[model samples]
Target: MPSETVVLLPGTASDEVFVRTVFAEPLSQVGAVLVAPRVRTLCERLTALDNASAGHPIVVGGVSLGAHVAALWAVRNPDRCAGLVLALPAWTGAADGAPAALAAKASARVVADRGLDAALAGTTGWLHDELTRAWHGYGDELVPHFEEAAESVAPTLDELRSLTVPAGIVGCTDDPVHPVDVARKWAEAIPGAVLTTTTLDAYPRALGDAVQAWQRAKG
Candidate 1:
């Protein structure tokens, strides 16, 4: 596998640090350079993808809302996208009532009405830790960013069907917010896209699965 630049974005309210932890090692194993852009809003994430693709076709990917953004970008800019590594796709099109969207909205409200610590109270495990770090990182922009993500739309099935690049979609069967069915739908819609599943506790393996799927599709 030749060296390639892979631009990966973090989930809604998630920072580059988390994205790096998820993809950096797997990408390194394939000699791919991982560029985890620090993006706080939808516009920033899209802008990062656009800027990264200026020189060459690059693999674009992300988790949850980030995955939705990446897929939409690839659908519109197929020529600029070498491949896709979408994980935890939350919804097919409009975010109306989507679990992830609702979760974001609820969290936003909690953060707004109470406070960051109040919103995070009683949360434990890796997700809690990650959110603690990322939410604090957002500071004043956190609520607005959450609202933006809650209102955002992902690529429609028809739009996804138009994508020509090889794609690797990952899902967690136990994750209610980002259903595995959504991931399967994405794989089924995009031509030659591959689907893989992993538990939340073992999500790091999903990146490698996605990369391998992309390679298999390319073959």
Candidate 2:
């Protein structure tokens, strides 16, 4: 791996704290100069990456919505891509009917009609906590972002097939939203990409292990 620059983006309703759980300390120990930039919209993420990559190519990847955005970035900017690490991709193309998108749409409605606090209180489980943390931190723009993300289109299958950078992908067998099959297809599409699967609870570890394995194979 040597010394490399890696920036892993967070998923929708996710923050830097959450993203770091998957790729910070471990990668830093492995000599990766990490830069986890916080950008709100998909456009912002791409712009930030472009700005950050002015002088050097860097490894870029993310989870769920972030993964969707990162995939497109890699396909469009192959020359600036050192590697990729897509994890838990939600869908390909415009996933209007995707449960994750539907859920976001519905949540956006709740937040819009009621309010962030009201909607947050009504929601339950780990998702509830995650949304609370992410949305609240997002401030008033959260609802609109959620609404927009709900209908966001993914990079076409052709885009995925066109990526040639070294890639390491991870998926959770227990996560229905980020289907393991989609992850498998992504791995198969990207040239020489490696795939790793684990339970939802073990995804962070799986991602670390997968990246290490890919680096070993590359070496």
Candidate 3:
């Protein structure tokens, strides 16, 4: 059988380098060609995947905004996507007013008003903790990419409710941005979706485990 393709979509203010570094090795074990696209819009990203894969069935996954995008795409292209792997998906509506949104908005405003340097100084620590320092060692190279990514996508709640693909939502109990309850809600909404919770520090490990489990269930 042909190996399944796994598309990795990075969260808001993230780049391909960071997402690739986190999932490349572990996910590769499933013999999946990991495609980490740099696009921001959900439709454009999914279109890119469709054009690249040429109708091959795929597993779609992403972090934060990326996760939201993946979920939206999987629902829209249910026949093309085999499943979903969502990490730290941002909540919409009432869930948006949570601490995570306030912090993200504040950070975005600072970057838009002050500059990347100032915004990075204040927000880097938060992102580092959430992503387990995946982009920390890359220095300035990752910052501009992140800023560009953030500018590419905006939040849309309607898209969130339409997801239908079987999904695995990986969330952190301690993450203010991706509350465990919100993740659970995503799983509950999607038919046969599963919500798995882990600590912020164990993100990579939890993601790897969830991917493996999802793949096994598919077989």
State the C-alpha lDDT per candidate. 0.89, 0.78, 0.64
What lDDT would candidate 2 get against the real structure? Answer: 0.78
| Candidate 2 lDDT tens digits, 1-219 | 458888778777677666776677667677787677877777787887788789888888887888888888888898998888777888888886887798788878888899888877875766677767878887877877888788887787789889877888887788877778888888788778888788956645565654664565355
TM-score between model 3 and native? 0.75
TM-score of each: 0.96, 0.90, 0.75
**TM-score leaderboard ranking:** 1, 2, 3
The local distance difference test score of model 1 is 0.89
In terms of TM-score, how similar is model 2 to the real structure? Answer: 0.90
In model 2, which range of ten residues has the least summed lDDT?
209-218
Candidate 1 residue lDDT tens string, 21-85: 88888778778899999999999999999999998899999988989999999988989999998
Tens digits of per-residue lDDT for model 3, 1-219: 787788878765566776776678768887777888766444566676676556676888877777766766665676787877777766743433555555556665665577556765644454656433434433444445444444444234455556555566777888776677777776666656666678977755565555654554454
Model 1 lDDT, residue 193, Cα: 91
Q: What residue runs in model 2 are displaced by over 4 Å at the alpha carbon? A: 122-128, 203-210, 213-219
